[model samples]
Target: MRARLLDATLELLVERGFAGTSTTLVSERAGVSRGAQLHHFPTKNALVVAAVEHLTERRGAELSAAFEELGAEPVATAADRRTRLRAVVEMLGDHFASPVFTAALELWVAARTDEALLAAVAPLEQRVGRETHRLTVAALGADESRPGVRELVQATLDLVRGLALASTITDDSARRRRILREWADVLDRELGKELTA
Candidate 1:
């Protein structure tokens, strides 16, 4: 029952921002009683937090799968690393094109001012960084202790968020592509290697 409520809340949240979605909509979407929704989440903020977590889980799975695909490839050189990174960037770009990002951003913006939400979503952000770093290290056999590795990781995540924001207004593929390429190039240079292309 709780899962259904959260999933429905997530969908509605993406479709409608925090202020636009309500308990009635959630109950209607989930085909549950208002009392049931209340039992699970006494306030809309609680539901929004749960929805954020659900979206985090979904994106985490997508990112994990992309990393798995990268690992399935044999990357032997800097050029190989660039190829994998670009593939990853493209996959991440596609995933963020969904409506979920808008809601996530809305929640993040709200979290900046709301201590409760900040408490809820902080772990999700940490998990994303840790998971991305682990996957990159595993796939490339690169020790994360290498200099600039943390910067590369941060660049990757920032670009992911930037891609979502850009896609909201312009629908420009060029921005995502260019940033991803540049970040990959920077990482490659830091690694003291050259790309084939």
Candidate 2:
């Protein structure tokens, strides 16, 4: 029942924006009584924050699973390593382009104006930033000991976020793919053996 409410809240928050996602709407969509909704979440802020956290945790688990699955297969050659690195970039780009990201964007935008919301979301956002960097480092075999490698990974994330935003405005898939491919090639050339490790 709580899961249903959180899921419904997530959908409504993404579709309606923060101002439009009312408690009543969430309860109605969840097919639960208003009393039940209040019983679980005493306030709208609580509900929205819980929903955002739930989605973030879910996405984080997905990323961890992908990493584990890839870890099971060893890279046989430099060519294979390059391929795997590129695949990681593509996977990260796809994650940024997902509905989870869109919903998180909505929350972020709303939080910009609401101090209470900002307070609630800032820590979650920081944790996500740290987790993403750690995962990217592991996925691409990035050598943080190298001067520019960490920054390059961060740049790649920023680039993908821009691409994801563009996708929200138009069908930017083809262009996004092109940019991702071009950037991947650039990283391969610049990072050299570090990326292939």
Candidate 3:
């Protein structure tokens, strides 16, 4: 029943914005009796909190798995850089259609007014950043824990965020591709000497 309510809330959260998603709707969509939902969540806020946790757990695993898979690929040496680079770029690029990011945007908006949701998401965000740092270091074979990698990682992340926000309203994949191409340029410039020809 708890699982049903959370799954329903996630679906509604994607369709309706945070304020628009309601406990009643969740129960209806879940086909869980109202009594069962109330027994689990007790309030709309509690249900939303569960939704936040649901997204956080799912997305954290998704990202970690993606990066882990990227690292796990065969890249015997620096001569293999282009292959590894393209694979990493494509992996990050796949986030453009990611339902997880869409759900996260909804969770981000809900967190603005919901302290519990914010609290639940904050640590997850930190863990994600750290995990990203580790993956960058592994991919670049540099101490990306240092300041230089911070700039590169944060810049790339910000570009992705800007594009993700735009992606919600702007239904143009060409525009999205253009935005990422520009980002690839920035990365190229920043990594010029280090790209190892």
lDDT of candidate 2 at residue 17, scale 0 to 100: 76
Residue 4 accuracy (lDDT) in model 1: 90
Scored by TM-score, the top model is 2
Worst 10 residues of 3 by lDDT: 188-197
The TM-scores of all predictions, comma-separated, are 0.81, 0.92, 0.82
Ordered list by TM-score, greatest first:
2, 3, 1
- Model 3 agreement with the true structure over 1-197: per-residue lDDT tens digits: 77888888888877887778888999999998889989999998888777777876777677678877776665565446545555555566566347677777888887777788889867776776676666655664444534576677666666666777776775656676766666655555455445443
Which is superior by lDDT, 2 or 3? 2
CA lDDT, every model vs. true structure: 0.74, 0.84, 0.70
Report the lDDT tens digits of candidate 1 across residue range 1-197.
88899888877767776667899999999999999899989998888888878878876787777677656666776677677666766666666666766767777777888999999888896786687667655654455576666666666667777778888777777877777777766666665442221
Model 1, residue 109: distance off in Å is 1.0
Candidate 3's displacement at residue 12, Å, is 1.1
After best superposition, candidate 3 residue 67: deviation in angstroms? 2.7
* Candidate 1 regions with alpha-carbon error over 4 angstroms: 77-79, 192-197
Q: Which pairs clash (backbone N, Cα, C closer than 3 Å) in model 3?
A: none
